[model samples]
Target: MKSITRYLVINISIWALLAALSAGVILTSLFRTSAEDAFDGQLDMVLKMLVGELATQLFSSEELSRPGSLGQPRFELPLSGWYWTVSRSNKDELVFASLSLGGENLTVESQSEKQYTGGIGRYLMGKGPDGKRIRILEREISFGPDQSYYFRVTGNAAELDEQIRSFENRAWLLMVLFGVVLLTASLLLVRTALRPLTKLQRRVRDVAIGKSEAIVGSYPVEVDGLVEEANILISSNKETLERARTQLGNLAHALKTPLSVITNEVRSSDLQNADMLVQQVDVMRDQIQLYLDRARFAARHNTIGTVTKADPVLKKLTGVMSKIHPEKMVDYECSADSDICFRGEEQDLEEMIGNLVDNACKWASSRVVVSLTEGLEEAAVKRPQKKNANVRKWLSIIVEDDGPGISEGKIDEALKRGKRLDESKPGSGLGLSIVTEIANLYQGTFSLERASLGGLRAELVLPAIKEE
Candidate 1:
């Protein structure tokens, strides 16, 4: 069976991991983009400084290198990966350059750097004169109407790469940690959410197997509605059965007196076939009795649940039977646990055992052996894969003797109602039928097989319970 808690936990964990990974990707991208935009903004400021602050200084200088500090001092150091240059537009002629250029002209791989221009100022990534990766910002500036020069400012791209790489590593690490926390939280929440459901299932199963009358204890508000509905359903079912039993009893009372009146009137009257009428009336009474017996057994099998100790019952029955059949040596053996019990009314258990023992004593030549043993039913042998779930218990009773046993082919036939193999037995052949009917009511089995004691073996298996 699929577990609800396991299903919920697994699905929640999968979604949590997916969401965390997607968040990591998106967060890292945004961080890197913000850092890159800030880095480009600083470079753009320096480009403005070169155009506004040093435009006149460069135009009047003959050597095109007289500068103390243009924007930052790093541009004055040779091969510092920060430089600036002014060149004639529409030509590759350098007019003025920063000191950090080291006498080498500034040029881009394409018509510009590794990237293209968009608006007034263009951003590009390219190799600088120092053989280091740099970001270049280029723009064509006109000091007058005709004279135009290209201004380019360069900065180190390696710094931006390092900062973005560091942020990516940290972001992925945080995402992984958050995913673990999320999965852990999901596991706890799933178990907590399902705890009440698990308890309710056990209670329902216990009620089904006659361990409890109905669900017990308080629960969360979310589960209280389900508990109420379940209790209602269980109570309604038992009530319906009880009402049906009451109605059937009322019907019996309504019919029984009338039936008795007809039988008595027919007998007292001088009818042509008075004996025949009495016999038919007797049969009708027998039929009604049989119907009521079936109805009673039907009501009992679904009883809320009761426990009856078997040891005392077995001891009492065997003692009574020894005196009832003094000529026959009737006995009993119990290999079952001391605490083993029947999961039904004491009378039902007595009824099934009494029929078997009585029949055994009737037919046994000398001795009879009645034994009880712990046994597992064929259907309940395989256990359910659940925790705290009840496993049904069962027991077997075998009654055998030394008398002549019936044939194997007649075993099934003998269980039929009114199937008297030998009329000389002085019975209506309803003992085994009654036993079978009651056994079936408890969802039990009754069979006749050759006993090891050289006689018929009546093996009855019924639902049982432990004392605890």
Candidate 2:
């Protein structure tokens, strides 16, 4: 699944793009309208000025064949796309024209009375003498009888088009720049807004890895309730597991006492069935012990903030093993990294390491070796120099002895619960089995192999806490 930050960023970016597009469209439209309006205003002024000039000539009885200049140089240049015309309304004949027309006429449409205002003129889009698009403004006026004329002024539509196109280009560029700024600001805002959540996530990881006991730090009011609830949930789960472990211990004690009594009673009896009853009782006791061990491991395996240093645990276990097997004349060798720690309950670590070291002591003729090291599988095999905390690492606890090691075929059988080989040896065959079960509960691995010491090698790989 995608993270919340990515989901929110994508959604916000999409909306921002949509809003920018909408703004661009609106701005482009307004720019075009304003450009056209400015063009029409220029044509209106020219048309009114031409009408006043023509009226002055008519009232003064001046026989002017051409209209005077309207103070715009383009009007005097031929095919310059700026032109004016004065024509008789009755005969539809051109009476006067600007020099810029170059002897070609401007196309004028017939206008209705309602189309023209009393003082204001009518504006239109039309073709000029040079066949270019143009804006035209026309007005009709009368000085006397047989003196009515239409005055029309036109400007090139291309200029207005160029101006609008230039405005659109700049407008779009600005909008794109604005969009980029907006998106950058939004991303920064999102990161800042979610910083508290990121802190919460790191604290939760710390709790899981036994670096801290509970969630800590101030959070936003919006997520403060969630933080409190998570702390409550952690406390509740710990309490529940503690209660369950206590109940399981009580149950195991209660059952074992009665089972022990039954076993003793059967042993004292002389009947033929008594031996069979004793055997069955012993089997029941073994089964109870196995299951009780499993129950304890299962209850404590996932407890948060539980850490055990391997050096102290290994030292203590090896010391106990040395005392237990003093007559074996075993020379015990033990070494462990002080910084290495197990991310689990201390008793569980004791149980697993104790079983392996005890088994090595039991079988060793003269020497037993126990070693603890932190390693990644890939690094252990190939690159031992590089260390990556994000990669999975294991705490390898290896016990090797100089006694007779089992063949590869029987190693699997040896790990099975209650499957004792060489019954002459005083053991219920649950040692390796219990170690295997605890390793499995911790999401670890166990293997048996030929030892460097010329006997059995029992190796355990359990999850290790990464160094900060």
Candidate 3:
């Protein structure tokens, strides 16, 4: 399943990035517009001052010289890019100019021209004294009819362009910083908001692994209903299983009482084939016991939080088997990475392992070895999840004895429910079969193979529970 926290964070970051870029673009554009306006306003003011001073020179056609009270000292410097000139608009006659022009003329290009009527001048982009890109503002007025003059002022625009570029660089840097802070804050807020869900998930895992019986915590209002429903479901399932077990036990007892009476009556009688009747009664009893055990194991197979440590169980079983076969001397060995556990009912585990160990003891010459499989660190174990019932982990328990091993062809015959390969052994020939059945019920596997110790190897795999 996809994580909600991851989804929310990715979406928030994308939108924040887009907003930062958009804000940066808009901020720099407004700054550039204001810069252009200030530059143009200064040029317009200087043009007006020159036109007022040169009005007297227009009356008499004296060769033009620098006008007075221009106030800007840059006009005195050669090629300073601050200059004023007066010329005839209809003819190429230079009437007057500032010393800043250095005896060079300024010409405005007609293509990049704009006019502001009602006493405002015309503006254009053109070349100045040294071929530098410049902004020219010119005003034309007629002293008499047919005698008109143009007042021109030119300034280099490199400072204005540089100022705009510097502002854009600074603006983008600040926006990047702002975007980082926004994403970091959003991440922190998302993690904080989802902390309750994380706790709830851990609590639920604890229940599945038998660490807890019920979900308990002070949860948010959004999750209170879920917690209540989960607890109720767990309690109700336990109650239902308990009632079913009680009913099955009662039924078993009720039927067994009549069977016992019939068996005793037939054995006391002296009729023909009385022994055969008793033998049939014994078979019926065995069948009843087998099915009853199967029913009990099936009921507990899917129950939640039923974990059993294998070490204690193995210890107890090995000691009991030793006493059961005093001459065989059975021993238990645990080769797991740590204290591993079986993820099933304790009784089921006992039944499976007990049957294998007992069978080993019965067939061994003088020694029997029961071992828990090694390399448990590589094989993970977990509870059966609700959404995926087939997904499970396994741990192996093995029992081998140094006795006469069966050939590969007869191995299948030996696992049949009532097929005993050796009649001398005092058993019903159901131990191996019963172990196989129990392993199947727990969604596990059982196999018999040639033992390394020159005996039969009975390998039983069962669902396991281990910490991460």
Candidate 4:
């Protein structure tokens, strides 16, 4: 499953980027459109006002050189394109000028003959000898009979265009900042909302590996029913498995005595084919018993899913071995915490550990060392103390002997059911096979390696059970 943090971050990033792009497009378009409309309206009013001013000169028939008359017209200071002039229609000359031009010649276009309505005009703007870009409006107004005059008005648009561009830049900056903040907030919201789900997932994993009895944390309403149902299923399955194993074990024990009596009677028979028949029946019975043992091992349970101390199990096995093989001395050693414990069925644990320790005693000349530690190997011995049954923390039980070890190539096949290196060696190869089955029951693992004592080592590691 994907991690929640990464999932939320990716979704939030995409949404934030899209939102920023959308806001930028919309805000820029609106501001530019609104500013253009406002400027266009102002341009129209300036055109009309300039036309009225020029009409006065044409109606009075004033001298072309007279100050504040037809020759020189006063205008508002800081004039942009708000300028006017009255000129003779025939000569195409300027009859009067305005301070809005500051004595500069006006190169107005004469498009009046083509079309004479409100339209765009290009002309120089400002009062300097040099001019800048501006839009001009031109129209013909009649002052009196045979006294028609040309009126032109213009305004500087450079500053207004700069202002609009500046506004656009600010808008984009604000959108980027908002997008970042929105993305951060969105990620946090996602993480907080999914926190319970994360916990549920972890609890489920613990149950799957037999580390937890059930989900223990609070859940949101959306998932509470699901959790309850899962807990019920886990409980039911464990109970059913245990019941099946117990019945299988009882059946195996019930048949063992009958099978042994038949084998003893067949062995004493004098008939030629009777010995072969007896051996065959004995083998068949052993196979049935091995499977029965496996079933019994699988059915056991860890009570309340609590951890059982590893040192105690190891010490108990060593003590039992001393009595079982009184001639051999079994040593118990531990390198892990005395508090170290694991989640496992008690019977299965004893079965697996018993097999390993018993085999070590059978083969060892004198000393058999057993160590129960919490780690995968000697190098990994030092680790954090926090225990979790379904995860990395491991409770390793290692049993080593100083007897001759099995050949390297046969180790893998040795764990197979009914397979033994030495048929003459007492007891069925079923011991190792039973150990393997028991290890699997609790989700534990086992390996046979060369021991430090130059013999065989059975290394078993199981997940540590978590405390309630």
lDDT of 1 by residue, 1-468 (tens): 278877888888889989999999999989987997787777777777777655666466544444456659889898888888877887487777888888886546544332433347677667877678887888888876666878888888888889999999999999999999999998988888888888888887678656788898778999899989988888987897789789889988998999989999999999999999999988888888889889877876666645678878877786777888886665545344577788777888888888888888888887778777777534324432211133367777778887899999999899998788988886788889999998777777787889888889888877776665
Superposed by TM-score, candidate 4 places the C-alpha of residue 398 at a distance from the truth, in angstroms, of 3.6
TM-scores of the candidates are 0.73, 0.77, 0.81, 0.75
Candidate topping TM-score: 3
Q: Residues 1-468, candidate 2, lDDT per residue (tens digit)?
A: 369899989988998899889999999998887887777778777877787777777778888757678888899998888999888875379888898898889875544243434375677677887778777777777777877788888898798899999999999998898889889999999999999999998998888777777899999999999989988988887998899899998999899889989988878888889989988888887778778878889888767667777789999999998888888989989988888888788998898889888888878899999988887443234433333344366788888999998999999999988788879877778888888898888877778889878999988878787656
lDDT of each: 0.78, 0.82, 0.79, 0.69
Summing lDDT over every window of 10 consecutive residues in candidate 3, give the lowest-scoring window.
378-387
As for candidate 4, its clashing pairs are: 81-154, 81-155
Candidate 3 structure quality by residue, lDDT tens digits, 1-468 = 288888988998998899899999999999997997777777788877877666666567766566853888877788877787878886368877888888888866663444644384677777786887777777787778776888777777777778999999999999999999999999999999899999998998788788999988989999989999999988887787788789779979988998899899998999799899989988989888888888888778767777888878887888887777876555544344356778888888888889888888787776677778532222223322211254345577888888898999999999999889999998988888988788888767677888888998888767676666
Q: Between candidates 3 and 4, name the one with more favorable TM-score.
A: 3
- Residue 44 alpha-carbon offset, candidate 4, angstroms: 2.1
Q: What is the per-residue lDDT of model 4 for residues 364-432, given as tens digits with 9 covering 90 to 100?
A: 876787877656775334433322344656778888898888877889998897787877667777888
Candidate 1 vs candidate 2: the TM-score winner is: 2
RMSD after Cα superposition, model 1? 5.4
